[model samples]
Target: MKVSCLIFFLFFSLFAVAQTTPTPKKKLVVVNSYTQYRAAIKSNPNNELVEIKKAIPGISLDIRYATKNNFMQQVMYKQARAFARKPVVESLKKIQKELNKKGYGLKIFDGYRPYAITVEFYKKASDKNFVANPAKGSKHNRGCAVDLTLINLKTGKELEMPTPYDSFSAAAAAKYEKVSPEAKKNRNFLISIMAKYRMNVLENEWWHYDFADWKNYDLMDIPFEKL
Candidate 1:
């Protein structure tokens, strides 16, 4: 009986240690060095981050994160410029041309955000659901995502959507149905046009879209000044 009790305690102690052991965290690789980015572009020119405005002239830029108008209520980027992968900019150029024919134009809010900014957003955002977790990084950090809205070219006024940019509500959803008929029509039209250019709208945010081949790019931490 004494021997059996001692063996049981030893088995219980081993089980407790195994249960308390923590798993190792996964390591994330973020490209922060300009030299590294240059090397990547040298290997594949498609990896180059092209300035959207320069690539597609006449594209309007709001760049809210450069001002204090964003959800953070603080300036995140020093410059009000936006950029994306070479192919991404090309796709936008085509989308812009098509929209222009319809008297509409693309107004960009943000693009190619540094990975560090994403970490800041995850930490500061009150509604965590809308923000991307830093552990997985964001498509914007990969320079393959864009935040934008449609605007009437003649009036330069934004089209009425279900909700304003960065709204943390169910109405912000790309297909939310409880909105006005005009909003639904405008939102669906924007989504369809963006889809035609390989930009898929985010399920939660109608204004957010990820390039179809975003996974091909690496998460970047390079600042706007470097690019």
Candidate 2:
């Protein structure tokens, strides 16, 4: 019958459209399992998360998230530790050596953040521009980013920067020119030194740097204790 043929044609058309339309992608790959993390390092040594302190004994750590000093105003990390991928640590080692020769050294604030903590940051952050969206993950989650500043090697005092770490102010931008001359000089020096070691600065954060090969690592949710 003509009615039956029309229904069949409509069904065929609907099925063809469904088949052609792409399905939504799976949720972003977040390596949360300790077992999976171990597997990853086993497969590629580069994936190993190296503790910054152990690797560079001379490096200073403030670890704000481990105390109540960060923007969160609550302890987010159980331990005051910093970490990065093996190559990233190596680059820091070289940069530290270079800085030490200049009577300067690196002071770490944060590194190798867990993806879960990033999600927590996004949920409560008043300035979304400063926080990473959980939907895409963060370079810090991949152990390929670091938050740091320069320090006086002899006096052990932090160099004056454009703005304090985790400042929501516009002056936190790496290239912001309205800062004092001394602060601008220190900020530019830090940026240039970090760039020399393949650590590129984040546009809006004077102290944040991402390793050139960040894409090689997967977003990780494994905590500090496991690393």
Candidate 3:
């Protein structure tokens, strides 16, 4: 009887140890093409969050409403609440100051997109031939990407960029040679500020740039209302 009791306790002890051991977390499945995701504001109207230029010094947006017909957006506009990402917003303020000295204003087209908005963008990217995949995690999904450009605040007009935001054609290319010098100057101002701040531009789009520290952020889906 004593031997049996001892053996039962030992078995119980082993079972408890096994139960205490934690199971490993599963690896997340990564999507294929979040790299090239941009949406037109028309399809994803979530870009209409209240603009807060003063929140970040030197930062201003030639917001669609701010400038009637001169607004620009991505083909896959994932509604990011960049206002929610204050650090990024603040960075834009610094960037705004840098560009202001050169007679330019940082007109943000998009920022801090909501997760549901990103999912919407993913669906748009799923359309073959016209767009690519947003299934992979997007830099925008990370809430560290910005769709923006330098605007001539004085003219109340958007500066000449190589291509309009989300242009799928060759005109969107950073080095599209046929672009005008004024456009190049505008593009250079954006590039210089971004480079100084360690931001990287998307190859096909002129107004897109992802912060270098993007990997540090988790994919966010927080909505504009929530922000």
Best by lDDT: 2
Q: What lDDT score belongs to each candidate, Candidate 1 first?
A: 0.95, 0.96, 0.60
What is the Cα-based lDDT of residue 219 in candidate 2?
98
Identify the candidate with maximal TM-score: 2
Q: All candidates: CA RMSD in angstroms? A: 3.6, 3.8, 11.2
TM-score to native of every candidate shown: 0.89, 0.90, 0.65
**Lowest-lDDT window of 10 residues in candidate 2?**
24-33
Question: Candidate 1's residue-wise lDDT over 1-227, tens digit each?
Answer: 99999999999999999999998888988999999999999999999999999988889999999999989999999999999999999999999999999999999999899999999999999999999999999999999999999999999999999999999999999889999999999999999999999999999999999999999999999999988
**Which of 2 and 3 is ahead in lDDT?**
2
lDDT-wise, the better of 1 and 2 is 2
Per-residue lDDT of model 2, residues 1-227, tens digit only: 99999999999999999999999988799998999989998999999999999999999999999999889899999999999999999999999999999999999999999999999999999999999999999999999999999999999999999899999999999899999999999999999999999999999999999999999999999999887
Clashes of each: 0, 0, 15
TM-score of 3: 0.65
How far residue 190's Cα lies from its native spot in candidate 2, in Å, is: 0.8
